[model samples]
Target: MDRVDLLPPPADAVAHRADAYAAAPLLNSLLREVAERLPEPGDRPVYRLPGGRLLRVRGERRPAEPEVRTAGGWRRVNHTELVKLVAEELTRHTGLSNHDLPAEMLDSRDAVAALLAARDRATAPGDPYLRSEQCLVTGHPHHPAPKARGGGPVAAWLPYAPEAHARFPLVLLGLREDAVVEEGDTAALDALGDAPPGYRLLPAHPWQLDLVSCAAAFEDGRLIRLGTTPFDVWPTAAIRTVYAPANDLFLKFSLDVRITNDIRRLWRHDLLKLRRTDEAVASAFAASPGGAVWLSDRGYRTAGFAFEELAVLVRDGLRDHVRPGATPLLAAALVEGFEGSPLDTLEDPAAWWEAYLRAVVPPVLAAFADHGVVLEAHLQNTLVAVTDDGMPVQALFRDAEGVKLLADVPRAQGWERLVYCLVVNHLWEIAAALAERRPGFEPWPAARRELARHDLPEIRALLTSPTLPGKTNLLLRWTGADGAAARYLPLPNPLAGA
Candidate 1:
């Protein structure tokens, strides 16, 4: 398959594209959360909003060009109007008002416009892996404000944005030996740059450094600037995490800005429990069958004075886990569509999907059933390594910070979280993307078969269940719920009949 030539569109074209991209997720959330589906027989599904307004949109997977039924007739809703409608409806539905979320929705749209413009000026990386890592334009396709950058100015966040195909050198710092707080194996930091005799080297994400205030520490000689890395690091889909091709290393840093749900900061509580969660996940993957790998979050380095702000996590790179001759691509990027996607030219989608299932499904299920480890196997956290023929050969799972152990949480709760992340967020999107490409392709039957192959207690119920848990991002954000606190609403289960 040949890579698509992404020529720069006109300013108006870019704005139009940005509007569609931004509105899709917001419409999806509104339809799923606060709106009731009305019995309409047309290609476009009509929904009754909370305040009795009728709304409709084209397509299902990526809903676009939303329209509202006014007194006169059907009227188109732009990104701005959509955000306003969503806010008003949510207020009526929830009987609560939130000023921040509405602002975030607008900010998200603006961010998309900025990203599109920046991408027009930037050159996408040639490496398939890097391209996949950086190719999430309409991120978290169900969130109302997926791309919102904490309402920061375009100049503030554009340089670090993954959607903009950004790659920049890491800002290196030297923390005084006494103020340096680290755990596990963070030896990779030392290799990036050398520190003075009394200081320990710490690599920082440039954007994060800009967001945080470490001037006091610098002035007191507790921290010192050691310049930037010689080699540039490619920002992955997770903007805070950068991949250094030279060392085959991944460094996850703390960025205070919120991208999707929560602020992209390495909180102290999570960092403290990181090793335990990572080790459990590693153990599960090690004992599991096949080549499915867990990219371990090795350790972290930070200044004791600013633990969360200064923290940087060292992750095991792709070179060791990825199969020989197989290229690893971000699973999310596959759904978002990229230059070198296997879905673009699949001779046999069923076989390709089966290979994908073989690589992705079993490990996640086994981790939950056999090892009592619930991996957050969402799209962003997964990598599908494919052969030269574009068939999936392996699945690499990462991000220990999101992993939950059944020992800590109730078994049922862990299972629900697992189901939401693996089945709903990950598999459903892939299945939808595939079915979109090949009309009449029933992805659910194969999904059902693969799922039924497992003997877990929940397997039977999962297959027969009328609905699956779909996280209510819109409602959650509207209610000002904790980002980590996942609240789910039932969504029609395709696997039930399949």
Candidate 2:
């Protein structure tokens, strides 16, 4: 055993991560929705909430080390105190009582502390792409408790944490051939490894296996172990979806943990409609110009007995869609940052921003207008491939699960959802990151130009709308609503008149 483990933990580690973890979403919600900025006092940004409650934070990006006005004035608020402060202010500001979100806030803080500790001891992946995928410590710019791992004990989920740079082999199983329920091209699964004559190969995420109860399946001869994979797979930002570099394939699993607003499970309803949804987006990309590709959810395989629990989704890997010389990087990592992120040492912010807009915006607009396909082109679902000099070469999108066809939703509703996902959630966040790094640089003009190029009627309104829809994640989690049933509040539109 390590001597450091024997020594009963340090105070600084816990407090530092907790403050950082707790501050971001609270600051995001407070500033974006409730608080009004009261000119910068020195270097720090200060805000005045309802009833003149003044709050200030140390920095931008992942705002840390919060301080608030008190009887003594300008006293530092710890994580616990911060949670109380958020609850109090929100209650008064929104005319609502949310007892649950406060707990999730604390849970998020505690979870961050756990991740930080685990990362300290863990070894990072050798592959830079994998490193980028795992680099998101502060995920979901506007989400409260983005790192909250279902409020479970540390050991229960720590090993599966992408933030900790964890990479482990999949738990391979042999489900009887009769029990295999599948859709689309699952041939890649067969190529993963061999299965016995009577059985079919089904690779499972180890963490998911641990969470699920499967003794009956194992005992009834429906499922049997066929040993683990020879090589390890890197878990992406979406913890349940892992990349196997050796096979050049992606496998998504059903995890029960609540990541952001929803329990990360591959739902049965989604599984049933996967082919239709993926085909629509795939056809859209096929027709669209600008080298934008769709990383299709090619197929899914699951056991009939434990359908959802055993379900595994197979998606197109980076090898297939990524341009020959260019490297594909997670769009979220471009915002969150990784070692080799093009966003980190951007030589020319304007050129970079334009290239980014060219890559991400066109296909999305084309898909919506031409094919009536609404893609959830949020940061996590989009991948931008860059050239040798870090200029974006291509944009590849994934996750058919979130696609909403215009035939299903009203045209107005689909457009609203598209604008929120593509512009507010994806583009605006990246723009803010670039702006922070290169002061006096604005990213919205180029963004506006890109949208105007689409010639869609929605683009005209999008440019003029005083407010953009921002997802109300904190409120959603507090109200205990379904994740797909997204509710939005208006955010001051930076795109307007830029």
Candidate 3:
């Protein structure tokens, strides 16, 4: 059977020291079988190929290639080509080839080395989410070692309660034997304190971890300490979840896997848009005196998974708890427009944008300047919280990975998904909001140019800014609105000439 054995423990494998993982004999055998099939069995193989496992056979007939559909499109590469690629990659990783090894193993040696390297990384220290554990946390400290305290026996604990999960039971750190600590466990408690700032602890539910395995008790039992395990919730891509762990702290998780390539792509595209948004908002804040600030993120993590989690929790959170037809900002906007339709009719195009911009836009721009960071500014990436009186009180921004500096433009040589998201998805949402307020909004092209000017000065200077392409035209309304003939009054850009 054609297969790949992914997890196997070597003589000095790192997993041997980790508490969560054990050896995978089945995987080891699978890898060896695949290695035995190599055409030239005596050659030494290189290792740690980037894309996938590959090895070239001097005389063995190549297998048929499989066509796989990816985001970019369908891509197909036969086993022979893949093997050569892997062989080259192996050389890149180990800097050794078959000639470097003894002649006795020439045909088989190289393939074995390549497979071992791939398996090693697949089972390495930082790679805890291998096939063995789809969503598992590693127990290794990623910090400076604390001085060994020979005080009374104590245990380390990290308690996590999912507020959105019906206040799910908390996960407590305990000992390997699951022994309960009576008194000296204070040190562990001191380290874990209640919760991080801007976050609060929630009451634990019955299902959560009742107790945690502590290092103190483990050390007393002469056991090696496993490091801190970061508690996380996993979800598939395509879903945005709303998560409330405890203490009314709300978080959004996108269901996407983060990879080095993905990070580079986003850095290339979205980074500049964010930078432009920051500068434009900076100008806006300089103009408005009473304007509040919008919170924007500065760093970007591929929020693919976080988005998924956020979607699920959001739907669930609002299903039974959120009040119907009681949007705080819209309700207040109704009070502002005494002659307009009721707040529920906010779906009306012109009225909606007016309400959105007046109530939401100013502060968001101000926040961009205040933080000296650009916000993706997309609808789902943002939160508008209201006070008891239904006024837009807090604009919460999350997903730092999508945030970037105006000065740090990524090379277009990478991917443009990041740019597509910020310039296309995020700006589109705002444009829609603006269009709903002003039907004649049509400055998307100019606005697009302005955005490039503000955020991507480098790129804009290099090439003419692309024409703004979208169904809605927001910039036209803001910039070209006729003062006397316009039904809605447009806010003049304070930095228009400059």
Best by lDDT: 1
Question: By the TM-score metric, which is better: model 1 or model 2?
Answer: 1
- Model 2 steric clash total: 0
Query: What's the true lDDT of residue 132 in model 2?
Result: 75
- Report the alpha-carbon TM-score of model 2 versus the true structure: 0.94
lDDT of 3 by residue, 1-498 (tens): 012233346653332222111111111111222222334235423222233443322211111222333466545543233434334443553454532111211212222232233333442212111111111121001100001111111121111111011112222222222222111112222222344333222212111112222244335642222233234332111112223322222222222221111111123233324435544444544444233343322222111221111111111122122233332221211211212223323444443333334444444434433444455444434444433333334333444445444445443411132333334444443453344445676535444344443343333522243332221111111122231111211122212321
Candidate 3's displacement at residue 397, Å, is: 1.6
Q: What's the ranking of the predictions by TM-score, best on top?
A: 1, 2, 3
Clashes per candidate (backbone, < 3 Å): 0, 0, 75
Which residue runs does candidate 1 get wrong by more than 4 Å?
1-11
Model 3 misplaced regions, further than 4 Å? 1-167, 174-246, 250-344, 363-371, 386-394, 406-423, 430-498
Q: What alpha-carbon RMSD in Å does predicted model 2 have with respect to the real structure? A: 3.9
Among the numbered candidates, top TM-score falls to 1
Error of 2 at 122 (Å): 3.0
Q: TM-score for every candidate vs. truth?
A: 0.98, 0.94, 0.30
Q: Please, what is the whole-model Cα lDDT of each candidate in the order they appear?
A: 0.91, 0.85, 0.28
lDDT of 1 by residue, 292-392 (tens): 99999999999999999999999999898899999999999989999998999899999999999999999999999899999999999999999998999
Ranking by lDDT: 1, 2, 3
